[model samples]
Target: MQESHSNESQIQIRLVTKQSEYAVPDIPLSVPANIETAGLNELLNHLLKENKPDFLKQKQFDFLASGELVRVSLIEHLQERSVSVETTVEVEYIQVTPAPQPEDSILHEDWVAAIETANRWMLIGCYDHSVSIRTPHGKPVTSSKEHKNIVKDVAWVDQQQPSKGLVSVSHDLTGILWAWEEGTDKIEPRVKLRGHERGIDTVAVSPNSNRLATGGWDTNLKIWSASLDGDDNGEPASKKKKGPSDISTRTPIHTLNGHKECISSINWTNNHVLYSASMDHTIKFWDAELCGIKNEIVDQKAFLSSSWSALSNTLLASSADRHIRLYDPRSTEGSVCKVMFTSHTLWVSSVAWSKYSEHLFLSGSYDSTVKMWDTRSPKAPLYNLQGHEGQVLVVDWSNSKYLVSGGTDNYIHIFKNKQIFK
Candidate 1:
């Protein structure tokens, strides 16, 4: 099961079972900046790596806690050398801790879009001044129809985070950043990010939750430091960030200027590569650190305007032309190799990859259907899940097998094969 704690970044564990039947070449899962290094050494002994099964079984202990989240399956059985553990048990939280802060509201509404409470949820911005929140199971739990104007863009942050409380983006009343607590009646404007001479179109937080990146109609993608870099608790630092206002004040670490048209989507990759899919009918890759153009492909089949993202080392881009293109981030300069999958009848609205299985990904379209693709084959969809009536706007997968989807028709649907139980 996927789990995280507030007091700690990495989960400490004491393993006592003689390791067996679970080993594999390590995944590229490096420790993020949020992980805490403390207590690791203390817990290692509790894991108490031993080779004898009788000794371990007799002690009644066997578990592997990485302090790192594992999203994929292991190819090898975890055994002695292949296994390790943590045992120093000062105190740990296995679930979301009510972060230490103040009175907060987990959700709020200007009118009535909808509200959702789950790990992998979605919020849609309708052009008609409405918003919709859906559960990870693909059910609309909350929605609002009484906004002053239409909802432009939507994003989410850590709701369980006492400090990060109620993270969302909306065009409601002069472009505001909101923070509320769960089951509360207060939604306060935490920061007013107004640097975008225009409206904010999209925003994404890093997996580590220390940074915020936004792309907008102003034709620019800006990455900002959402919190201090010193600790995982996300405490405010005494050092001052350049600017007059606290929010929208920090200079965008990188300002991409190549897209001739509005950028439809942006995603971060494992190797620190940043990708932008633009209306200019091309997809470009940029070195995350160097901030220089690495490769650009023109005439990406139907990928004129699409929403796409990356997984591990692969990049997926969708296009209005009615096709999705997959590229290897490791492809060398002037030698980029790509495979295209033509399946959708209209613009590909959203794309997401399964964290547990990189080879599996999903795409939603204007045609009102969500299709799951097995990148292992790169040709067509393995499952054509159908339910939504209007244009499908957003789609995300919970760990690997469960799927969550949303559409413009004001409906949310969860799709999971019965075989998961089998």
Candidate 2:
């Protein structure tokens, strides 16, 4: 018996029949071991005759359905590796087939992450409930088994937690929070958190583990608070007893309001301040108190009152009305500072801050170009990113000098500095 080499989708079991007696050779467990079994006589033998023995019935066979693994043992074996190389493919999307499994799923099967066993380069993950973990940069280091629903969004909160937990946001306002225990192959669901009135569009984790915020079509932002030791304590949700105006006192400690339309995005600067964008063509800043929001806005006068030039900070409120206003978080006082704004012909759908550079920001829109600006230079775009076939929907940067943008064309574009878009 000899070890075989293959990609994520297949495992080749090469058995050598040089002599009548042979034994299966061991393979290095570090290479992400997977096993396929066949008879020694049938291994690597293709029969030309139509009627052959049952063992040699087929050659280069494929797995119809994966068999149950009886046991998993680690072993040390000889190593032969392919050359390490790099290239980029600019396409709408690449479809990767999955390994044969007892059950099938609808996710595209790219090995987005290196096998938990090793790390180097990867574009996808295991197709059998595969959860490919990718940072803003395309370094595929970790991935888990994809669970029940397709994940709409995911966030990592506790860095020191042994099993790094991920909250997989789903379209049904319900989700499974999973954690992978270190040195083990278990990614069990911690629990299911609830309280959204409708489908969840956005979720944000506070700097501290004290709170979690969710916003979406229900036109409400619910804040959950507790100090559970990463256990499943989801209080089963039912109809609200209080009237329509009665605030929910379940897990949601605070539920903020003031948006007439569905929420577009939410960002948590710290444990207290929550910044949110909405379809009302506005961005609002909230001071989340204990189960409540400090909804007081400064009804102050604009410095450039001639235009929509209100110098407000609480409302880093920029809009398609060709204006960005800084409204007062408090009452109209003397000009503390000028509110920042940007000029876009179409609506600004999203905004992202640079992880390395504090004040640098990027915004994408119905317009094809992604404009970069700094806090001091919001009046004009510092530079433009022009490559997406359609409107850009998301823009995020990592401290490791990589910028990632995803658009409607179903492609993720990675760019470095002003040029070198991959």
Best by TM-score: 1
How far off is residue 129 in model 1, in Å? Answer: 3.6
Lowest lDDT 10-mer window, candidate 1? 96-105
TM-score, prediction 2 = 0.52
Off by over 4 Å in 2: 1-131, 135-152, 159-163, 181-188, 225-259, 280-289, 296-340, 398-400, 417-422
Residue range 1-422, candidate 1, lDDT tens digits: 12332323343332222234322222222222133323322233333344323334212211223322121221111111244223232211121111112111122232222222335444545565655554444444455444355554555554334335333334442334445444343444445444555555556556555555666566676665555332222445446663423343234556667776666666555345666667777677776567778887676443433333343566677777677777665667654446677788888877777655555677888898888876643445767777777777767653344565556666556665322211
Count: clashes, candidate 1: 31
Tens digits of per-residue lDDT, candidate 2, 297-361, equal 33222111111111212334445454545444454566523555666676555555554443455
- Which has the greatest lDDT? 1
Error of 2 at 404 (Å): 1.7
